[model samples]
Target chain A: MPTREINGQSIEFDNEGFMTDRTAWNRDIAAVLAKEEGIETLTDRHFDVIDFMRKEVEEKGTAPSIRRLNKLNVVPTKELYQLFPGGPAKKAAKIAGLKKPEGCI
Target chain B: MKKLLILGAGTAGTIMVNKLAPVLDQSEWQITIVDHHETHYYQPGFLFIPFGIYTKKDVIKPKRDFFPTGVEVIFSGIDIIEPEKNQVKLTDGKVLSYDYLVIATGSQIKPEETEGLVGDGWRKNIFDFYTIDGACALAHFLKYWEGGRMVLNVVEMPIKCPVAPLEFEYLAEWWLTEQGLRDKVEIEFVTPLPGAFTKPKASQLFGDFLDKKNIKLTPEFSTGRVDAANNKIISWDEQDIAYDLLVTVPTNMGDDAIARSGLGDELNFIPTDKETLQSKAHENIFVIGDATDLPSSKAGSVAHFQADILYENLLSAMEGRPLRAQFDGHANCYIESGFGKGILIDFNYDTEPLPGKFPLPGIGPFSLLEETKMNHYGKMMFRWMYWNLLLKGAELPIESQMMMAGKRV
Candidate 1:
C-alpha cells in the first residue's frame, strides 16, 4: 500500500507498482505512467490501447490480453508493442491501472 | 429421467462422470459423456516424449477405459451448443439436451495463430511438446541430430501446464549433458512472464536453477510471430531470438467448440465463477480443466482439485441448494528439474508457493518448493495414480483447499 504523489494527487500502488486504487487513475496520471514507461509523449494510439484496456477491465473485470486485443482487431499486436514498448501487455496494464495479467505459476 | 451431459471425456469430465454416476441414483439421473476423440492421452507424459523417456504406450489410451459403467459415451464431433435451449447438437445431427451440463473440452495448442509457425520449418526445426504428435516429432528430430541454439518460447501466459516448458528446458539441459552435446548447445527459455514462474519465490528459485544449469532466460517476451525461415522468434516489440531448433508453446486456447457456442472468452475459455465452478453466463452449465478462464494453473492437478468442488456444487445445484463448496483454485505440481530431481509446489488462489512439507505437514512424504528425488518419484508415480485412482474419482488424501498447516510464510 505505497502511496505516491502522481499527477499532484496521492495515488496508491501495489508492491509491484501497479496502481491499487484504479479509480484514482485519470488521463493525466496515464501521461505520467506513459512517461515512466519510456514513452515521453502520450499519443492517440497510446490512449487507444489504454482506453480499450480500461473499458475491457470495466466490462470483464480483468484486462484483456494482447492476444485478445489482436483477435478482436482492437490493435495490431505489433503496433501494441510499438506503442507500449518492452512488455506491451504488462506496461499498458500498468498505465491503465490494471493488475499484472493473472496467470498460474 | 433427468439428463446430465458431460462434454469432453478428458480428466475432469471423466472424473465427474465416475464420481456422480454411482452416487446420483442411476434410476433418476441418466449420465452421458461426449467427446470427439476416442483416445485419452496422458497429457503430462507428453513432456517426456521428446527425450525418449516415454512413447505412445505411456500417453495414449482408449477414452472408454476410464468411463464408469452406465454412463453413455458419444464419440462424435461437437457442433454448436444451444445454451438457451439447454442442448448440445453433435455434428451427426443428433441433439442431446440436458438438465445440467459440464464443459471440459480442454485447451489445445493453436500454432496457426502465430505467423510462420505452421509453415516450412514446422515439425522440422520449430516444434512443440504440448501434444503427443509434437512431442514425438521433436523426439524424431532430436535423434542423431546435433543441437545448436535451442529456444523454448511460451508464446503467451495461461498456457496449459505452465511448468512443463521449464521442465522441458531442464530436461534438455540434463539430457544434452548426458549425451555430451551440452557444450555445443545453447539453451534459452523465452516466456511472456517476467520470470520462470508466476509466483515470486518459486520464480526466483527456478530462475536460479536455470542460471545454474546454464540455460539463458528471456523474460516478458510477448511472442508476435515465428520467423521459421530465419530460424528465429520475433517478439511483438521486434526483439528477436534466433534458434536452430525452436520448441514453442504456441498460444493455448480452449476448444473451438467453445467459440462456436459463443460461451467463451476471446481465447475460447469459458467465463467461469472461480469459487462456484459454474459458468458465469449459464448457471446450469459448469466449466472445468483448461476450459475455464479461471486464473489457475491449467494442469491435471487443478482439474483434480476442481472436480471435488464441482461434484459437491453440481449435486447441490441439482438439489436446489446454494453452492457451499468453494474451489480454492488449488494447484499442486511437481516440476521435473531433470538429473533425477524435481520440485514440488502446492498453492491456491490466495497463497503463493512456500517452502514447507505437504499433506502430512512436518512429516510429509513430499516437500514443497524444493527440488528432491522423492518429488521426482512422486511426479513419475502420478501417471499410475492418474489412470487408477484419480480418474476413478477415488478420494485422495490431499485436501482440495490449500492449507497453511506446514508452509513457511
Candidate 2:
C-alpha cells in the first residue's frame, strides 16, 4: 500500500491518495491533507464540515455528503464547492481518513 | 504495409473497421482497433436495465465477437497519443505507429466533477443510469425504495443521448404507476438547459408531454451540488430541488486520454471539422462520434450516420482525392415514452425536429415527434438493428444526409 508522510508520521493511502485507515485521521492530519487538496488554510467552516463527516462516518459508517450536510443546515451546496475546489466528496473523504467512496468516477 | 489505427472498439470504431475492411486493399493496409474493455455494451439498452426491461446479458457482448475477421483488436488502455509522431503508446509500454488514425473514443459521465455528487449518498440515494454499475445499483435501489420525491437531473449539457433523461422520466412514471406507487412518488426533471431539449420545436413538443405526465420541469437550474443528507440537489442560485431518490446525469466529458495527449478542447473533446469529421489539429488524424467536438447529438444514430460519411472521406484522403462527402450532422432518436408507447425525432444541424412520417415520405410507418405504439415497437426493435446492422456497418434505408421530404418544415 502507498503511504504519505504527514507531520513526520507515515499515513497509508490507496493509489488515488485516499486514506486506507479511518482511525489514523486527526486534525493535524486533516490540515496536511487540506493543503494537499489545494486549501491554504483550514477555516472553522472547513472544520465544521470535516467534523460532520467524521461524526456521520462514526454513526452510519460513511461520510456526510453535501445533500446530508444541507439537511444539517451547516452550509449550502455552493459553499461546498468553494471549500473543496474540485471533487469535494473525494477530497473530504480523503481528509476525513475514510476509504474513497465507491461510484465516484 | 501502411497501418490504420483506431481507438475505442465501441459503436463508431467497430463500424469504421467493418465498413473499411472490404473497401481498403487488405494487402496494402492493415486495420487495428484498441479498447481497454473486453465487452462491448449496447448502451441504449442501459436505459431499460433499472426497469428490468433488459438484463446485463441483453446489452453486453465481447468486443472480439463484432470485429471483422481480418481486422486486429487490441484490449489495452491507451497511455498517450503522440499525433505529431504518428504513434500511440499503450499502458503496456508498447508503441504502434500508424499512417492514419481514427479516434472514436466517446464521452463518459463524470459524477465527481460535481461537488457532493459522489459522496456517501452515491449509489445509495443518488444513482446514474449511464454506467453498467450505476444502472444495476439503481435497479436494486429502486426495487425496495418506497416512493417519495424522485428527481432525474441532468447536471450539464452536451451529454450523449440528450433525450435519455426524458425517456427515464417517462419510464419511471410508467413503472411507478404499474407498481401502484405513482401517487407516492413525485418525479421532477431538472436540467441546466433552459428548455426540455436543445431544439426549440422539439422542446416545445416534449415540454407538453412532461406537462401532461405531471412531471415538474425545473429548467435552467445550474446544479451546484448534491446534498445527499437532505436528499436534495442545490443549484448555483441556491434553489433546492429535494428528492428522496435522485437519478443524476453527471457532467459528460471526452476520455481523459485525450486531455493527457494534449489534443482536446476545454471539455477534452477533439477539435474537428464539423462537416469533414477530420481533426483540425492534425491532417492525418480523423475523429468521429462523441470524441469529436461536432455540433451533433452524441447518440448511436449520429455515429452511424457519421460513419457513412467518414468512410468515404477516409478513402478519399488516402487516395489523394479531394474529399467529396460531407457530414450533415444527421441524427435520429427513438424516444421511449413508456407504457408500450414511444416517439421518434429526426433532425440535422440546420433542422429542428418536425412532425411527419419517416423513411418513405407520406407512407405510414414511424411517426416523427408523435407518440405512438408503432414508435415504441421501433424503439424496442432497435436493439436487434444495433447488433446485427449498425455495428456491422451495414447501411440502413435512411440517407447519410438529413432528408426534408416528409418533414413539416
Candidate 3:
C-alpha cells in the first residue's frame, strides 16, 4: 500500500495509485490528486464536475458517468472533455476519490 | 504412397485432419498434422473470460483428444516451408518431404508491432483480451477496480474474430451495471473502420445499438502509438483519446514461416485461389482459415465452411479428377450483446449481413441481424459445438454456400 500526504492528511492508494478508501477524500486531497493527474490547477468547472460525482455517489451509490452527466445536461460533451483533457470520467472519479473502473474497455 | 503434411493443428488443421482421415485410405496416404503445442484452446471463449462468464476449465483441452487414430500428430515448431521442393524443415533440424501440404497455421496478435503498447502500461492499465494470459491478467485487475473510462480500440483491420471487441464493450456495459457501476464508467468503442462494423448494413444496425447504449463510437482514427505514461492513444493524424484503461487489438499477422519460405503475401498470409482454396504459388499446396489471404472474414465459421470445400477438392485433386468443389466464403457469427442477449449474422464473400431468418428460408429458430435471447444462447451453446461437432468435422445442418432465400434483397 502506498500513501499520499496532502495538507497534513494521509490518503491510502492501491498498487496502481488509485485511492483505497473513499472516506479519506476531501477538497484539499482532490486538489493534490488532480495536480498529480496532470491538471496543474482546478477551475470552478472542475469542482462542479467533482462535486456532481461526489453527490451522485452519495445519492446513487456510484459516481455518474460522462454519458449520464451529458444526458442530464449537467455537463456538455465538449466541455467535459475540455475539463478533464484525456479521460473525463476516470480523472473526475479519481479526483473525487473513487476506485478505478474494472473490465475490458 | 503419398505424404499429406498439415502444419499447425489448430481449428482449421484439426478439422482438416478429422474430415480427411477416415475418407482417405491410410495405407496409400500418410496424413500427418504438425503443431508446436499440445493444448487446443477454444479461442471464442477467450472473450468471455475477462468478464467472468467463462473460465480456464471451459476453454482448454488436449490436441490429441480430438485427433483421430489414423492421423499422426507431430509436436514441433515449423522452421521453414520449402514449397518449391515440396518439403518442410522443422525447428529440430528434421526434414519431411510431402506430396501435398495444407497450411493451417493461423494469424496471431502482434503487440510488439505497436510502439509503447507492450511497454509501461501493458497488463497494468492497457490490456488485450485476445490471449489466455492477457485475458486472465485483465480478469484479475478488474476484480477490485471500481469504475472509470474504459476504451476498447482496434489498431487495424483483419484481426481474428473482428466483432469480439464490440462484444466486449457490450458485455462491459452489462457487467458494470451488475456491479452497480454503470453510471461510473464511460466506455468508448474505437476503430479504424468508418462505422460500427465492416459490412455496410450491419454497421448501420450496430451503429444504432451503440447510440442506444450510450457507448461513444470513435471510428476512422488510425492509431499511431500508445502514450502509456499519459494514458492516451495518439492517432497518426495527431488526434489523441485518453483512457483510464485501454483495451487494444493489435495488428494480426500470419505465421512467420510463410514469410521465411517466400510463399506468402505482404502480411505473411498464403495467397490462395479464393474459390478453390488452392495455393496460387504451388499446385500441391492449399491453405485454409486465417492463414489464407482470402477476402473472407477471419473466423471459425468461414474455416468450417472452407473445410468442407477443401476436403472434396483435395480428394478430387488426388484422384486425377477435375476439382469441382468451390468455396463461396460463407461466415456465420453470433454477436453477444450482453444482458444475456445476442444477435446473429451470416454472410459470404459478396453479401453483407442482411436482416432475416437463418438456415431456414422463412421459419428459422434463429433470427439474423436482430438481438434475441435465443441468439445469446446460440453463442453460449457454440462452445459445445466447437469442441464436439465443429473440431470433429461433424457436418452442421447449415448449408455450405450462402443462400439468399431468407435474406432481404
TM-score of each: 0.97, 0.80, 0.79
lDDT of 2 by residue, B33-88 (tens): 99999999999999999998888899998888888888888889999999989999
Ranking by lDDT: 1, 2, 3
Error of 3 at B206 (Å): 0.8
lDDT of 3 by residue, B194-312 (tens): 78898889889888888888999998766768999999998755689999989899988899998899887656788789899999878999999999988788999989999999999
The candidate, 2 or 3, that scores higher on DockQ is 2
User: Model 3 clash pairs?
Assistant: A100-B147, A101-B147, A105-B152
DockQ order of candidates, top first: 1, 2, 3
Name the weakest run of 10 consecutive residues (lDDT summed) in model 1 chain B.
B220-229
Q: Candidate 2 lDDT (Cα, whole model)?
A: 0.88
For model 3, what is the alpha-carbon lDDT of residue A58?
78
Which candidate ranks first by TM-score, i.e. highest?
Answer: 1
Off by over 4 Å in 2: A1-105
CAPRI docking class of candidate 2: incorrect
Candidate 3 regions with alpha-carbon error over 4 angstroms = A1-105
Between candidates 1 and 3, the lDDT winner: 1
Q: Which pairs clash in the backbone of model 2?
A: A66-B227, A67-B227, A67-B228, A67-B229, A67-B230, A68-B228, A68-B229
A1-105: candidate 1 lDDT, tens digit per residue: 889997679998999889987888899998888788888998898888889999988987888877789888889888887888787878899988888766545
| Cα RMSD to the true fold for all candidates | 1.4, 14.6, 18.3
lDDT of 1 at B292: 96
